[model samples]
Target: MRTQIAIVGGGPAGLLLSQLLNRVGISTVVLERKSRDYVLSRIRAGVLEWGTVELLRTAGVGERMDHEGMPHDGCYLAHDGRMFRVDFRDACGRQVMVYGQTEMTRDLYAAQDAMGATIIHDAEEVALHELDGEAPFVTWTHDGKPFRLDCDFVAGCDGFHGVSRPSIPKEVRREFEKVYPFGWLGVLSHTPPLADELIYASHERGFALASMRNPNLSRYYIQVPLTDHVEDWSDDAFWQELKRRLPEEVAERLVTGPSIEKSIAPLRSFVSEPMRWGKLFLCGDAAHIVPPTGAKGLNLAVSDVHYLAEALKLFYSSGDGSALDGYSEQALSRVWKAMRFSWWMTTLMHRFTEHNAYERRMQDTELAFLECSAAAQAVMAENYTGLPY
Candidate 1:
């Protein structure tokens, strides 16, 4: 098989890239290790930066999102038994869309199918060859048969654990990472959300976030020890812990229900530098990862796709490879800023066991300052709504 670009992941990043490129008459083939059902079954973050929302519209997959997704002007921060709102529009003249990653991926798949784009699911043992040479190709197996795909370039959107990142030689790739000591115990419930917008709470016990996918589906999380398991907490216990961390007033109106999905996710900030090597370019989790506190994971991936797709488009149209050469620098500049923001937010909201009393006081003071100072709030709003592309 032959294609202009071989995308080594069928997630949102790869599919969106294919969607954008296909619209401009570029050919792409997406390779996925899992079945389509498995990909769509995974639950993920719901908040979308305004830039991401616009990009989806540009890719022709935003119709459903704009129709069903919630748009919020701001979110709340809870501390010391009280909560304060940060008006994104008032501070930054922008807003974020509350749309689940799963739903967005589904929309992208539908669009891809309608356009007859190539997406091969359940591809096994995918490998890249001659990535540093003029000719690059990918190989994988399916149904006891070997296959090879020759392409001009490869997109490593296969995520953190995928083969794309590891394909880069160790000597050429530099990585930075910080693994948090705690994890988030998240629950998805079939009930109305606690509030109109998301609420991030920092309490004496731990951290909690009250979020929603839609009016009838609520998503909530509470910080937990890394050693904790999903089976450790019952639905009632999870709600009680969440209520304790939230502000009294907000918790009063909370609607409790049976949890449909539950899991524990450890927090981490990871980045593999030089997102491009020869004909291979990394995108999304394959290149960088941010703690979820800033809601930047899926949004960050979209930005990477934007950079890569445009670079490829420019190269093909104008015969100018400059954008392709500069893809890493441009994407990394924004990636680092998001890394800092997510790290700062995680530190501010999470209760670290290693922190002393003085450090805890500083966290409280920082949140307090952010609540009262317009300048600080503006900075938060700018970062939260997303830094420019």
Candidate 2:
């Protein structure tokens, strides 16, 4: 099989890139090792930047999102039983939508299928070719038959573990990483949210977050030791900890159904410089990863692919590789900014024993400023809701 562009990984980045390219009359093929159902059902980051929502709407895939996703104008930061609302709407005149990443994938998948784009799922032994050359393609097996895809260019939206980034020469690539001592133990349940907006609580007990997937389902997370195991948390124990962490008033309304799912994700911030190498380009988690505190993971993925789609369009039409050449540097500028924001959020809200008396007092001072000063609140609001893509 041959196409103009061969996309590796059918996650949001690859799928969205294929969709955007297809819309502009560029032919592409997407390869994935998992089934379409699996891709559509993977739960991930939900908060959508206002610009991201607009892009999806313009791309003809935002109808269901607009219908089912709740608009959050702001979020609450709670500390020592006090609530400080950061009004994103007031700060930037834009509101974020609380919709699950699964829903976004479904929308994109449906749109791509309807447009007759090529998306191969359940393909095994997927391998990349020509990583060091001007031409690159994917080789895989589908239904026990060997197949090869030859394309003009390759896009590695395959994520951090995929072959895309590893293809870059190690000597030339620079990697920056920081692993945190904490992780988030998240639970999904069939309960309505305790509040309309997300609540980020920095309690003496721990850090807790109250978020909603929709009106009928809620998602919550608590900070835990990075080495903690999921089996260590019992349902009853989870609820008791939640109650201790949340504000008194909010805790009263909190209700959890049997946990439909639970897992712990380690917190880390990593960035790989130079997102492009030759005709191959990397986007999304393949190039950078941010801790979940800022809710920037999926949004950054969307932003990277959006810029990529635009660049690819110009490349395919005019043969001017300027955009592709600058993809890494351009995307990294925004990626690093988000990395800083997520790191700041994680450190400011979570407790650390190593913190001295002065360091401990500084957190309280920062929270007080965020609560009382309009300027401080505005800064939080802007970063929380997101910076313009």
Candidate 3:
């Protein structure tokens, strides 16, 4: 098989890239190691930066999102048994959209299918060849049959554990990572949200986040030890712990119900520098990862896709390879900013076991400063709403 670009993952990053490029008459093929059902079944964060919301609209998959997704001007921060709101619009003249990653992926898939775009699911043992040469190709197996796809370029949107990142020779790739000592015990419930907007709580016990996917669906999380397991907490136990961490007033109005989904996700900040190597370009989790505190994982990937898609479009249209040559530097600049923001948020909200009393007081003082200072709030709003593309 032959295509202009071979996308090595069918997740939102790859599908959105394909959607954007296809609209401009570029050809792409997406390969996935799992079935379509498996991809859509995975639950993920819903908060969308204003820029990400706009990009989805540009990709022609935002109709459903704009119709069903919740748009919030700002979110709440809880500390010392009290909560304060940061008005993103008032401070930065922007807002974020609350739309689940699963829903966006579904929309992308629907758009891709309607356009007859190529997406091959259940592709195993995917490998890249000649990535440093003029000719690049991808190979994988399906039903015990070998297949090869020749393409002008390869997009490594296959995520952190996928083959794309490892394909880059260790001698050329540089990686930086920080694994947090804690994880988030998240639950999805069929109930109304505790508040109109998301609330991030920093309590004496731990960190908690009150979020929602829609009016009837609420998502909540509480910080937990890394050694904890999903089976360790029952639905009642989870809700009880969450309520303890939330503000008394906010917890009073909280509605509890059977959890539809539950899981524990460890926090981490990772980045593999130089997102591009020869004909291969990395996007999303394949290039960088941020803790969920800043809601940057999916949004960061979308930004990478935006850069690579535009670069490829320019290369094909104007015969200008300069943008392609600069893709890594351009994306990394924004990636590092997001990394800093996520790290800062994670440090501020979580109760780190390693932090001494002085360090804890510092965290408390920082949040207190952000609560009262307009300048600090504006900075938070700007970073939370997202930096410019």
Tens digit of per-residue lDDT, candidate 3, span 1-389: 99999999999999999999999999999999999999999999899999999999999999999999999999999999999999999999999999999999999999999999999999998999999999899999999999999999999999999999888899999999999999999999999999999999998899999999999999999999999999999999999999999999989889999999999999999999889998999999998999999999999999999999999999999999999999999999999999999999999999998999999999999999999999999999999999999
Q: In model 3, which runs have C-alpha deviations exceeding 4 angstroms?
A: none
Cα lDDT of model 1 by residue, 251-341, tens digit: 9889999999999999999999899999999999999989999999999999999999999999999999999999999999999999999
The TM-score of candidate 3 is 0.99
Q: Per-residue lDDT for 158 in model 1?
A: 98
TM-score of structure candidate 1: 0.99
Better of 2 and 3 by TM-score: 3
TM-scores of all models?
0.99, 0.97, 0.99
At residue 277, candidate 1 shows an lDDT of 95
RMSD for all candidates, in order, please.
0.5, 1.2, 0.6
lDDT (C-alpha, whole model) for all candidates = 0.97, 0.88, 0.96
Quote the lDDT for 4 in model 1. Answer: 98
